[model samples]
Target: MPEVKSQVDPSDASPFTRVRQLAQRAGLDGFLLALLGAILLAYLWPHFGSDDGPLPLNQIANYGVSIIFFFYGLRLSPEKLKAGLSNWRLHLVVQTTTFLVFPLLLIAARPFFDTGNQKLLWLGGFYLAALPSTVSSSVVMVSIAGGNLPAAIFNASISSLLGVFVTPIWMALYLPNGGHNSSLWGTIGNLALQVLLPVVVGVLLHRWLSAWAKRYDKQTRYLDQSIILLIVYTSFCESFYRGIFQGYQLTSILLLGVLLLALFFGVYAWILLVSKVLGFEKGDTITALFCGSKKSLVQGTVMSKVLFPDARLAGIVLLPLMMYHALQILIASIIAQAIGRRAAPEVPVPEPVAGT
Candidate 1:
């Protein structure tokens, strides 16, 4: 019989194919592409979802944010948190790095951005530092790196809960009095209503709904991302309308990106050193590296809505976080892959069989 020939379509050899191949090689996959697309679309059509626009996007996004946290609560496993609580030392280090060390580092950089809008930009950086470690990504990266998965989940979950209270207190120190529609106590109350209440309810229902939540996890994530994108779009629209981004030079934006990258690596290195100094095991060190280094875009976006009611300032505040989010995912993914490769179990050599 003649050997079978393989079929290859000419369309498969197109330039689009080559571009996709190159993108994959460089790790710029669909999610990153979608993020870029969202920004560009926000920039080009800022009016589409503006406060005075055709649709009530802001209101919808506000509700969506609450739902996102609700699902987050639903998905969290109390058993996992209980199991991981034994690692008190590791938890202390991760949380300290997140809320304390990260802020101090950004505060130290304040002298550099002491100019006009640069100060606001610095505030953005400070807010990013004050935010919590990402739950999903931190756990994902830790698992990928053969780390203590339970501890990662515990720290990330606890970090989010802590941020609901801690982040606003930190911001209150800097944010102008009466910038919000409500007083500090009122703001916290509102946040509790919108974010914390849903979370509490979801957690209460988790025993019954966890399996359902697990089944629809991907859809939940998609909803979260969509809500985030809507928030971003509305934020930029407000910024564009008020000319908040106009004063910012392109170089300034680029510098912010560079600074965010440096901040990520700097924190990562500090965490790694601390892990070593504290005599953490390899797995625990990996958990610290991932959990201590990450800042949650989810928490940042949701909290920003409640924290900064000033729409114009919200976009500026979110800028550093947005950049950090992208950079962290890119850098952490590469690092996780490297760590995973090192931790992978070696294949056992097969013994030659007597029959062979």
Candidate 2:
């Protein structure tokens, strides 16, 4: 008999290890917990992250946003983006589902939330709907499900760029009387400076810097997470200091959570059916599902600061987005793993030997 190695059985693991394993299987990220922790910290000590606070957190977060997009652009290749565009049919479906289908679904839900706190929650949902697909999560989910990575990357990149303009336009159209109407052009200009400009500069330097950016991808991700936590903390700091989140009860918040999940599944079902109707290959279907259904919390967070004018309002806008971001990650991770397992090709069984 062969000697056994020193492997430990999972059942023999400690409680903490078992919990960690369960979390990993469920696709839970520590960042999500950190996000909630940031909010809690903000609630407890709002002044630390506020405008007059010693830290100047908002400004730091703003600068970090620029660096995030710049590094994003630096890591991508113009040639690859072009190459990924060859599938016009797939591209059209993905983009249409992203910009048109997602927002329209929310627009249809506006009537149900015309009064009170519901309206604010509904507005947040609409904003999320209008936002672009996420870059990393969409691509990661698609890749796990055996989708076309090139197309996922291209669609995600293009979607972020498009959202810089499109999200503002959607807000302008929907909020004409909400004080943000006339400022659409101004908002776009600010985004151009903070978002578009950095991306353009990064792309220009991609040939020289792409390798360095890729080499330090893990570090960059940590920096991105830190910046996001800072942004969330500062935003909620202003909200708590101003007493914005106190108006709604916990039940209302829970209701919004339920509604957001409905929104996700509604979109997912639509994409699942339509991709089949369009005769999408497995990869294309996977890409369409993931890329089409995602919302970009990164872009949403940065843009909320520019769009809301008030930090408290920005915090309100981010509420649904933060919840949706967590929910989508969990559900999508499960789906991706399931699809990966089921979609794998079966190994061929060998025929019986004639001699036997």
Candidate 3:
């Protein structure tokens, strides 16, 4: 007789598979986890990423930032960005919410947080508000939720481009609130080098590099994440080396987490109400909520090095954005999945009949 064998259920998977499944269910992005790992690495080994360290990570980060934006420009579709422009009302709502209401919410909450240590965290929140909407993630979420894909693409792309201007201006206005009049305009000239110039070059080269961008999209994405990790690591390394986090307590971080959650829900709820008031259809509403409510971590990390005069400031100043980025992705994912499921057309079950 052949040896009898027991079959394992698919549910009983390897530890790694189970963990991955759990992560999917919870809508966790690996990039967010990698960010935590980068911070941990920074804390554990600040010396390697120090300004005077052997690797010259600062120079590497500077160069890497340009490359990331270059790839961004290479992949951007000028036609697709223009396709959704007919819906001026939707565009108005999305852009207004992103550039206006988002910041106002932070300003409304300002009085509660402008004290000593809290002031820094509040400044971080304002920076997050000032940053523009994300691109890929916004489009991805809107697509999943059965939203207006064209408008999603348009608003998200425009937001990123606008951020190259709007964010710095907003920061310049708010930096004074923290009693540090860091000349964000002076930084804008630097931005034109690392941020704008590369974007312009990439756009000019788009006809040639577009195909390459499509073919190696995944590889380019990994490069983007790697550069981001490097930036985070290096910035935090400088901060830790200089003892910038010394004044911050565990409670302060916990409070920041609470505030970030509130901000996410706060903006989300506000947009949902506005979309309804504006009589937007389901698709446009979803686009408005996801696109308008998001803050770009890519822009945040890329701009941080230039925005803050002190390398040490980048680490703390980035806390609110990193937190909000992780939070929005998580919450938006869950909401999108639920909405997708609800909107899915139900297939009819077959009824047994005369055959019997």
lDDT of 2 by residue, 1-356 (tens): 99979999999999999997677666565777788999999989998898868987898888988987788788768998898878888888888888899889888888998776678788888889889989888887887778998999999888988998899888876653556434779778888888889999999999998888889988987887788888889999998888877779899899999999998998899988988998999899999998888888888887777777677666777899998988888888888877777877452211110000
Which residue pairs collide in model 2, if any? none
Cα RMSD for predicted model 1: 7.0
> Which ten residues in a row are the worst by lDDT in model 1?
347-356
Off by over 4 Å in 1: 1-27, 345-356
| Estimated TM-score for each candidate | 0.90, 0.92, 0.91
Tens-digit lDDT string for candidate 1 (143-182): 7778898888899899998988888777767774666534
Q: How many clashing residue pairs are found in candidate 1?
A: 0
- Candidate 2: C-alpha lDDT: 0.82
lDDT of each: 0.82, 0.82, 0.81
lDDT of 3 by residue, 1-356 (tens): 99989998868899998887567555565777788999999999988887867888988898998998898888778888778779998888878888888788889989998667788788888888988888887887787778998998899888888888888888887664342436766767777888888888888898888998999998988899899989999998988888878888999898889888998888888888988998999999999988888888888898887777567777888888888887787788778777776887352211101000
Q: Give the TM-score of candidate 1.
A: 0.90
Better of 2 and 3 by TM-score: 2
Worst 10-residue lDDT window for candidate 2 reads 347-356
